[model samples]
Every structure is written in structure tokens, then in C-alpha cells.
Target: MDFNPPPYQGTNRILGGKSVTMQDVAEAAGVSISTVSRVLDERLPPSRSKAAERVRKVAQELGYRRDIMASSLRRGGTGTIGVLVPRLSDMVMALVYEAVFRAAERHGYFAIVATSGDDPAQEQSAAESLLDRRVDGLILATSRLDDQLPAQLRQRQIPHSLILRTDGVSRSALGNDEQGGYLATRHLIDLGHRDIGLLAGPNFTSSARDRQRGYRRAMNEAGIPVREEWVCESGYGIEAGESVGYSLLTRENRPSAVFAINDDLAIGVMAAAHRVGLQLGQELSLVGYNDIPLVARLPIPLTSVHVPFDHVAALAVELLLAPTEPSDPIRRVMPTLIPRASSTPPASS
Candidate 1:
């Protein structure tokens, strides 16, 4: 007899042997379907060694493969997660996405990335689109916590979690913003600069606002009054920092020390100061946050706060994946300050 070529296996297509199902594997292993599933997913704890071994043996014999898509579909899911972040261009946000993607993959789910361009309206639209596509859960870095988007997600009973940030009047796991602020400020202050200036970020973002608050807290604690005129407000880009940094430095007898909300803004401030022939860490001491990849490499090294993205990202994923009620979303992580070459005591103090 001639041997036939291996046939494709699907609903209609026939292979030489019968297709293996969960029930078939369970019967072969002498266990329940759920046991087979648990074994296949390795979901059972180490205590269930004998049970796992039996299921693994049967699966190996039958070449049983659990079709994740079919499983998710049967359970009314797409096994896909929606991730909404501010912008992929932001290094910090990108790191968060990478971690979330890896976490989702391990759980047999696909991740879809969306950007809201820092607009509430854009975030809503992105969320709606994700929902329409039937994602199993959502990981959002764009959440304002108490914003309408969170409210809407709650009303719909959607599975969503915040990463990099949490909704609250107070800062959460993403950082010890107050402490970071204090460290940055105290670093400048300790360097003998009393009249420090804060080149702030977009006031609308809670993260940005917190840094400003942190600056104030440190100064207040030090008994040094914050020069209100020295604090310059700006938005989220290099240009924002440049304009704010330049304007702040040039407009008044300028602050001898400057603290920026993030590394990008700090870099901008550095560039602007360079244009005016002011040496960093000499005449002016500068501090920044989000010690990104370029911090150490910059022409003038950066003194900034390091928010551990890996820890925060993993925590966010763990929280999202946990089978828990809506009791309370926990605040999980915090940022640390890293002093670099760019900061020093001002000449006049």
C-alpha cells in the first residue's frame, strides 16, 4: 500500500490519525479536562507534581495542542490586550510597553498599542476602538485615574489597569516623586544654590504637577522660599524646555539652579544654556527626572531621578493578571534619584 502525504488538520480536512482534543488527552491521562488544561498551561502549583506529570505524558503521547484562540473565543474573549500610552516616542513610556507586551505574550495574549497624543478625546477614541475589537483587558499609561475614561471603563466593567501611573490625588508606585523632587532640589541646595528654579512640564499631567509639588516641598522643608518668578512653565517637548529654559534663564537675574520634570526637558534646558555660553554644573546646577538611556552620554552628564520601569511594568502586569475583585487598586512602585556629573553647587550659593 502506498503511504499518503500528511494531510492538513482543520474542521473538514482529514489526517491519517484523528485530531487530539482536550477530552481525548484527558481520557488518555485518566484525568479531567481541567486537569489536562492546568497541566498544559502549567497553572497548577508545584504541589500537583503527579497530576502534572500524568497530563504532560498524555499530551506528549497524543501531541495535543491547546488552541488558545478557540479557547478564548469559547470563553467570549479574543485573548488580546489593549495598551494605551501617551506616546511611543517617549522613552519611558516605550519601556513600559515593551514589558507589558512580554508579560501578555507569556499569558498567550497579544498586545495592541495605542497612543492618545496627550488628549482626553484621543484617549477615549482609542479606548473605544480597542473595546470594539474585543480585547480581553486593557493596560493604560494614559489614565488620569479619576478621569472620565476610568469612569467609563468602570461602568462597562472592563478589565483595565493603570501602569506608570495610578488614579489618585497622591502619587503612586511610579515614583517617589516627592522624594525625587526633594533629592533633586536638595542636591542643588546642598551644592550651595539657594534660589533654585523649576523648569516645569505640562501642568495638566498629574506626573508633571507632582514634580513641581516635590520641588516646593523640598524648598519649604529647607526654609528656602521658592522664587515664584524663577519657575517657568512649559509643555512636553524639547522645544518646550528650550523656550522655557531660555526665557527663564534670560528674562530675570535667572535662577542659579534649574530642575526639569524629565530628562528630555532637561536636555533641552542644557542645549539652551549652552547657546548662551553658560557652563552646566558651573554657573548653574541642573537636575532632571526619568534618567533615560541618554542621561549618562549627554555632552554634560545629567543628574536625574531613575524610575525603575521594569519593576513598575512587571507589577502592573501582575496586578492586571491577578484574579481579584474591584476592592482597591494598589499603589505599587516608586522612583529613585541618581546623581550624575551635570549638577553642582553654584558659585554664589
Candidate 2:
């Protein structure tokens, strides 16, 4: 039996079979190996600008790739970050994770993500798996209000930060859900919508509770009674939203407007409206949270609260990389409202 590897492709393989190294680049550029290393690693002093430029050009032409694992080991770090989210199938989580991955690359760190299906037990298991892989830190976007994983991470002295959701006991980088809810409700109220229904998310998550509070506050400030029947707790998906929206919209005295806590729920509400023969922004004004890309491309552009996933991800990464004391405060990012064709004054029925 013979064992051999395949030939390298492109310019990466050079020097008659061996991969290009700093020594080859240094010799070609007429500079010492240390100078070549400094130039390639971008650690050269300002006095060596010409030499650095020459070395960089030579290295690029030779297709010299640095060994990231060796460099990380030299620095006593893994140069890898782990991310945990509910599931990538959720567009919101996928977009957030995309931002995390991009930000990690910008910081010269690799990011690996895993799904926990929003289950605390699954989250713990996934987190343990990430730790076993020797990740330098973690970014969690699967926290419930009563989750103990953040505490456990703290006990273990792991460098971690929470995104999208938080337990309020950990360093978190998340949008201001209460403010987003308030903004969504207030937009409806300002448009003369007195009766508003809410398709709130599950109560276990702080985001759901906070958004509900904001809705209540907005309605109360406008002197509009929040009908208990109009407020339905829903799962974070289109199916749950559709089921709840159908029940609410079919009622004899259904609210003229509905505010869904997420785009998925909003989409479900739209489906229910179609079934109920209600025209959005006319017979029934609707608003959604998380101004995902699909919302604007909808037949009727959705009014939504825009939570900047990139900003949240960047901040979460920064917090995870930062050396912070146990007493460091949690961080919150504010959201903005993006009005579109889906929200308007209630139609005269």
C-alpha cells in the first residue's frame, strides 16, 4: 500500500515542492529573516518602510501563508472564538452570526458557531463542546431570562459575552427590546390606531418580557387599554405567529393594528391577514420588530424596529475579548424604527 497526498494547487506550492517560507521571501527580498518576519507580520518600525514594502511584495508574489496555529501558540492564545445561537434557520440568528463571523475575521480570529435550539440543557452541552475545542472565548445568543449557563461560565472564569438575549446577570450586547417595542407601539398610536394587538414572544426570554412592557407602556401613555385577549404569547416563528394572529384577527372585535415582536411572527401575521381577507396598512396596520432584509422586499414593505445586528455583534466580540472584572456592567444597544407601507391609520370599517 502506498500513501501520498495530492499536489498543491496554485502559487501556494513553490520552491520545487516545499511551501514558500519567510526565509525564501527574505532571501529573495535581500533582507534578514527577522526583517522579513517583521515586515510580513506588520511589526516593522516606521524606519523600515522601504524594506517592509519590498518584503511584503516578495512575500505576496511567493504566496507565503503564515501558520496561524503556530502564531497563536506563541502568543498563548487559540486565536479562535466560539459562538452559540438558537438556530441558523432563524434568519435573525443567522444574520447576527454572520456579523459575528465577519467581526471575528476583522480581529484576526476564527469563529466557530453551534446551535442549541434555544434549550438550556442543549446550550450547556454545546458550550462544553466549544470549551473542549480550546476556544479563546465565547459569544452566546441563546440566553433565557433565568438561564444559569452564564453564571456557570462566570464560575469557570470563561471569557464570554451574550448577544441578542441576556439573563441580566452577564455582560450582554443586545438591542433595547423595550424601547423597540415602545417605538413600534408608539408608531401605531401616532397613526391613530387605538386598538393594537401584540404577538409577543415566549416569556422565558428577557427580550419578550421587555418588549411586552414597552407595548404596555406605550398603550397606557396613549390612554388605550391593552386588552388581555389581544396580547398573545407566541413562539419565535411564523407558525406560532400565524396561529395567534389567526385567533386574534378572526375575533368579532379584533384590534385594528398588530405589533409582532419579530419578523418571523410578522410574516405569520401577514399570512393570517391574507386568510382573514384583511389588507395590511389599510384594514389592519401591522408592525414588526427586526427589520430583516425580507421585510423591505415584501409586497407590502413591513414597518419594523431595526436592531443593528452588526453593531451588536461587534460589541459582543469586543466585550468577549476585553479583560473585564466580574462587576462589569451589561451593555445594551438601542433600536430604531423603520416605517414602511405595512403600518398606517386604521381603516374606517
Candidate closest to the true structure, highest lDDT: 2
Write down the TM-score of every candidate.
0.81, 0.88
Clashes of each: 4, 0
Give the least accurate 10-residue stretch of model 1, judged by summed lDDT: 5-14
Candidate 2, residues 189-259: lDDT per residue as tens digits? 99998889999889999889999999999999999988999999989999999999999999999999999
C-alpha-based local distance difference test score of model 1: 0.76
* Candidate 2 local lDDT, residue 325: 51
Instruction: Tell me the lDDT of model 1 at 253.
Output: 83
Over all chains combined, what TM-score does candidate 1 have?
0.81
lDDT of 1 by residue, 144-169 (tens): 63467876776777877777666762
RMSD to native, candidate 1: 7.1
